[model samples]
Target chain A: MDLQKMMDLPGALAAFTYSDKGDLQSHVLREGTELTPQVLDLLAHSCVANQAIASMEARGWEALTGQSGFQPLKGFSMVGLEWSVVVDGNCGVVVKNRDADYEATFNALQAA
Target chain B: MHIVKQLMAIPGVVAAGEYAYRGDRFSYEGALTDEFARMASILCRANTLSVNMQSEIFDSFAENIGCRPVQGWIVRGSQITICAVGNYFAFIENRDELLNDVMTIMRAKVGDVQDDLLVNLYARLGGDTKEALY
Candidate 1:
């Protein structure tokens, strides 16, 4: 997803692209935002770990329950005290919790 | 009046329960079989740990950034979604406003989670964290 598009997301303070291993490749931060490159880098790395672990859970859940619809995982979101980060594949966007639309954020991540 | 029972009372809640830090002991109610419940327990533990680690890492980068002391997390799938607050986990079928309702209720019940993931979870289970290895 284009960094601009990600930035356009409601409450979005930043958008970034990360490596499969969670290294932050590039990022765009909104003006006057407290988020720094260092913070975004750490956030990217965490996103990778969390997403991978979530995928594993999804697979195990399907196998154990004999259920479908959870596989091919769309995305993952970590709800923080004041904000949330939504990510899919290698793209992620961080939005303020007050303005976050989790459903929309997930949809955007998948759409990207 | 159990949290699991409260969650199970929701219309679209398929399963709700509490899992131990090790993911070995769990108690739940809903449509899942014994094996499925076990898997869910492990799933919740894994996710909880993952998010907790992430939150701690974020705090290390910058303190009081509002990402620390992680509250919880959600995995939104195509039709099924799993929401976790503290040691409690809920599996719900996606529907109109159901996710928000369940989340609100769970947050209200579980309240805000502490920063120490191991201590936070172990305290709820009445276990000693000092001797336990992460």
Candidate 2:
């Protein structure tokens, strides 16, 4: 794999990371937002989804998702039924219902 | 480790692998843990929301073990910018958890507003090509 390509994968996916001081930093971005889901998806695709498998397999990271974006790329393990993104004030709660029957994950944000 | 397995059960929770803070890998499972008592304490704290189910648990494990836990997630959106800092890792485990985290962060900037279009815009911004944050 091309070194540039390897690096580009992370770039394409919009992957991000944060520090302990809440001073958020991202590889693909300058600041990291705790509430954004789209960015998270991109990061997963590059890291956990496609490149992650290759990276892990080269060194060997276990396969979480059997799907084929990358043969070894670890797909998300779906354990719950409903996944909700609930926002309250400036804070958001990403909660999941363990039961497979749950549906709605987003509940109306409480009035500030 | 039942905790590890429980997290793997969630949907969109990729890379449900196990790791040791002192050892070698850390697995992230999406969604917040159902441990009401612990969650309640976190809830009582100001600006506490379940960024992801496993995020809190991983933090707790870190606290107990005296090792920092590592998590990674991607944020994609139309208006959102992706800026280059370094290698960014997400604390929230899965897609659902990441969505919740995004809403929580947006609420602070916007307000108690829920606009599907706006939400979608923000989400799209996460995947900004140049990686600009604003």
Highest DockQ, which number?
1
Report the number of the highest-lDDT candidate: 1
Candidate 2 residues B1-49, lDDT tens each?
3433543443443322222211122333433232321321222111111
Q: Flag regions of model 2 displaced more than 4 Å.
A: A1-112, B21-134
- Calculate each model's fnat, 2 decimals: 0.77, 0.00
Which predicted model would earn the best TM-score? 1
lDDT of 1 by residue, B54-111 (tens): 7777787788888877778888888898888888989898787787688778878987
Candidate 1 has an lDDT of 0.82
TM-scores for the candidates: 0.86, 0.19
lDDT of 1 by residue, A2-105 (tens): 88988888899889999998889999998887788899888888888877777877787787667998877878888888788888999999998777767777
lDDT of each: 0.82, 0.26
TM-score for chain B considered on its own, for each of the candidates: 0.91, 0.22
